[model samples]
Target chain A: MSALFEFCLRMGDNTLVLGHRVSEWCGHAPVLEEDIALANTALDLIGQTQMWLGLAADVEGQGRSADDLAFLRDAWDFRNLLLVEQPNGDFGVTMMRQFLFDAWHLGQLETLIDSADDRVSAIAQKAIKEVTYHFDRSSGLVIGLGDGSDESHARMQTALDLLWPFAGEGFEADATDLELAGAGIAPNPAGLRAAFDARVEQVLQRATLSLPESRFAHRGGRTGARHSEHLGHMLATMQVLQRSYPGATW
Target chain B: MTPIAQVWEWLDAVPDPEIPVISVTDLGIVRDVDWEDGTLIVTVTPTYSGCPATSVIAMDIETALRDHGVDRIAIRQQLAPPWTTDWLKPAARDKLKTYGIAPPQPAGGPESCPHCGSANVERISQFGSTPCKAQWRCRDCLEPFDYFKCI
Candidate 1:
C-alpha cells in the first residue's frame, strides 16, 4: 500500500475505533450529562473518520467507500493506535484514555493544518475545532475527578498507569510514517512527543495525579503487526451487520 | 434560467431539520450559490462533522430547489474556512433566542437564559441533544435550555 493510503488509514482507524469505544457509553455513562457528552464526542470522531477514510479510498483507487474500509477490514488489517483500541474500563479510565489521546490528537491536528496535501489539511482544519472541544471536556474531567475524592483520585491514577504504556505507540514512527513525513504529507510521529508530554504533564499535575515512570512502549496496532485480543471482539461487533449482509444499506 | 438571487431566496425558505425557526441560509451553512453550466451548484458547509442534520439539510435544499423547477442541482460540501458560529446571521441569533435556544456567545457560554432573559445561568453540560448544542439552565427561571455553543 502507498504511504499516503496507509497514513489515511491510520488516521481514520484511530478515530473509528475510539469513536466506537466512546459511543459504547451512550446509555451506560454514569450520568446523563456525561452520557450525552460521550455520544457527541463519538459523533465528531466518526465524522472525521469519514473524511480520512474517504481520502484513503480515493488514494487507493479502489471502488471502496469509507464505510467499506471501516467495516470490511479485519483487525489485523487495521492501523489504529493501541491506546484507542483498549477497553474503556470505567468512567475515570475512559476520561483518562480520552485525555491522553486528546492531548496528542490536538497536537497532531494542529500540525496537520499545514500539511502538504490540501485534502489532509482541510480535514484537519475542520476536525481541529471539534477536537479542541473534546480536549477541553476530557482534560477538565480528568482534573476534576483526579482531584475530587480519595476514591476518584486513586482510580484516575490507576487508569493513567494502566494506559500510559499504550500512549508511546502514537509517537513511534515506521516506514509509512517516515515516507509521509519526508513528503510533507504528514508530520513525523516522533516529533509530536514533546507537545504530548507537556500537555500530559500539565493536566496530570492539575489533576493531582502522577505520571507513570515507565515509558515502556507497546507496539503493533499501527503497524498491523499485532493487536490486543480486545480488537477482534470490537471488530466482531462493529462489522457484524455489514459482514453478515455483505451490501446492506439504510 | 432562474436568477441566482431567486434560488437563494428559495433556499432561505428551507428550514433546518433540527431547528425549524431558522432557515439554512440564516444558519450560515449555505456558502455559495451559482450556475455551473446547466447545473445549479449550492455550496454548503456543515455545522458539525457528525451532525445527522447535514444530509437532511442537503436533501431539503434539493427538494426546495426542485420544487422551484430547478432540475440539475449539485450540493457541494466545503471544508476550508470551516463553519463557525460567527457565520450565523445576526437576525438568526435573535430568532434562536426567541425560539428558546440561546445564540452562540463569544464568551463560550450562554449570556443568559433565552426564556427569561436572566443573566444567572449555569452550564448543565458541555453537550446537549444535538452535536451543535450544549445544555444550560437558568438559575432564576429554573428552566433548562440548549445553547448553540460557539465552535
Candidate 2:
C-alpha cells in the first residue's frame, strides 16, 4: 500500500473502531440525553470512517470498498489507535476516553484542513465541524461529571489515569507519517503533540482531575503491529453479522 | 427542449427528505446548477457530516430533474465551506417555526421556543430524531420541540 493509503487506513480504522465503541452506548447510556449525544457522536465518526476508508480504497486502486475494509479486516490487520479500541469501562471511563481522543482528533483535523491533497482537506473540513461539537460535548461532560459527586470525581480521575498512557500513541509519528507530512498531504502527528497536551491539561484542570504522572507509553496500532486484547473480542461481535450475512444490506 | 432555468425551478420543488416543509433549494443544499455538454450538474453540501438525509436529497434531486424531462444529471457533493444552518432562507425559518421546529438561534445563544415564542427553552438532548436537530423543551408552554442546532 502507498504511504497515503496507509495513512488513510490508520485514520479510518481509528474512527470506525472508536465509533463502534461509542455506538455500544446507544440504548444503554446512563440517561436519555447521554444516549442521544453518544449516538450522534458515533454517527459523525462513522461518517468520517466512510470518507477516510473510501479514500483508502481509491488510493489503493483495489476493488475493496469501505465495508470490506471495515468488516473483513482482522484485529491484527486493523490500524486504529490503540486508545480507541480500549474497553468502555464505565460512563466516566467512556467519557474520559472520548475527551482524550477528541482533543487529539480535533487537532489532527485542524491541521489536515490545509493538506495539499484536496480530498484529504475536503474530508477534514467537513469533519472538523462535527469533531468540534464532539469535543465540546465530551469536555463539558468531563467537567460536569468530574466535579459533581465524590464517586463521579474519583471515577473520573481513575478513568483519566487508565486512559492517559494510550494517548501518547496519537502523537507518535512513524516514517510514513513523516513522509506524508513532508509532502503536505498529511499532518505531522508529532507537531500536534504540544497543542493536544495543552488542551487536555486545561480540560483536566477544569474537571478537577490531575494529569497522570505515568511516563510509560504503549505503542503500535498505527500499523497494527500490536493491539490490546479488547480489540479481538470487539471485532468478533462487530464483524459477526457481516461475516455471516456477506453482502447484507438494510 | 428544457432550459437550465427550468431545471433550477424543478429543483426548487424538491423537498428535503428529512424536512419536507422546505425545498432543497430553500434549505440551501443546492449550491449551484449548471450544464456541461448537455448534462445537468447540481452541487450540494450536506448540513452535517453525518446527516443521513444527504444521499436521499441527491437522489431526490436527480429524480425530480428526470421527472421534469431532463435526461442527464450529475449531483456533486462539496465539502469546502461546509453547510451551516445560517444558509436556511429567512422564509424557510418561518416555515420551520410553523412546522413546530425551532430555527437555529445565533451562535451560543439560547434557542427560543417555537410553540410559545418564548426564550424559556432548555436543550433536553444534543440530538433529536435526526442528526441536524436537538431536542428542546419550553419552560413556558411545556412543549418539547426540535431545534435546528447551530452547525
Top candidate, metric DockQ: 1
Residues B1-151 of candidate 2: C-alpha lDDT, one tens digit per residue? 5676887788879998989999998888888888888888889988877778989989988888888778888888888777888788899989888999888878653468878889987878777888888888999999889988877
Docking class of 1: high
Question: Backbone collision count in every prediction?
Answer: 0, 0
**Model-by-model lDDT, in order?**
0.94, 0.89
Tell me which residue pairs clash in candidate 1.
none
lDDT of 1 by residue, A1-250 (tens): 8999999999999999999999999899998899999999999999999999999999999799999999999999999999999999999999999999999899999999999999999999999999999999999999999999999999999999999999999999888888988989899989999999998999889999999889899999999999999999999999999999999988
Q: Model 1, which residues run further than 4 Å from truth?
A: none
| Candidates, DockQ | 0.87, 0.72
Instruction: Report the number of the highest-lDDT candidate.
Output: 1
User: iRMS of every model, one decimal?
Assistant: 0.6, 1.3
Q: In candidate 2 chain B, what residue range of length 10 has the lowest lDDT sum?
A: B105-114
| A77-168 per-residue lDDT for model 2 (tens digits) | 89889999999999999999999999999999999999999999999988998899899889999999888899999999999889999999
